[model samples]
Target: ENEVVASMSANVFKVQVAVGDKVIAGQSLIVLEAMKMEIPIESPRDAEVAEILTQKGATVSTGDVLVRLK
Candidate 1:
């Protein structure tokens, strides 16, 4: 299992995937907006989403725990 941390290139705006969803490597799990740009947070490997630690429109900072994968 691995913890998916949200590293914002800008600012966190929304979370897409939820716990129990099977995700492929490089899949977008969260969406972030900052500086008029949208940034996507992606899965690093094939795994099930174990936990969703943030909600839509929630602000998250760099290195914040966003999801857990198992």
Candidate 2:
């Protein structure tokens, strides 16, 4: 299983992918907000989204797993 994790502490601004969605490398999966900036979290490789571990408006910390991929 592969997982997408948060790189910094922030609030989840948007979830761009849904479960079962096929994604390509560099595809934006989630957008996080911190210090008034929008940071996009992208897929590191091509895969199908297996699960979304975080939701929009949720708060996450650095290294928190946001999505699981297969």
lDDT of each: 0.83, 0.97
lDDT by residue (tens digit), candidate 2, 10-50? 99999999999999999999999999999999999999999
Q: Judging by lDDT against the true structure, name the best candidate.
A: 2
lDDT of 1 by residue, 6-48 (tens): 6664466777787899999999998888888888889999999
Which candidate number would show the highest TM-score if scored against the true structure? 2
lDDT of 1: 0.83
Q: Estimate the TM-score for candidate 1.
A: 0.86
Q: Estimate each model's TM-score.
A: 0.86, 0.97
Q: Model 2's lDDT to the true fold?
A: 0.97
- For candidate 1, the per-residue lDDT at 11 reads 63
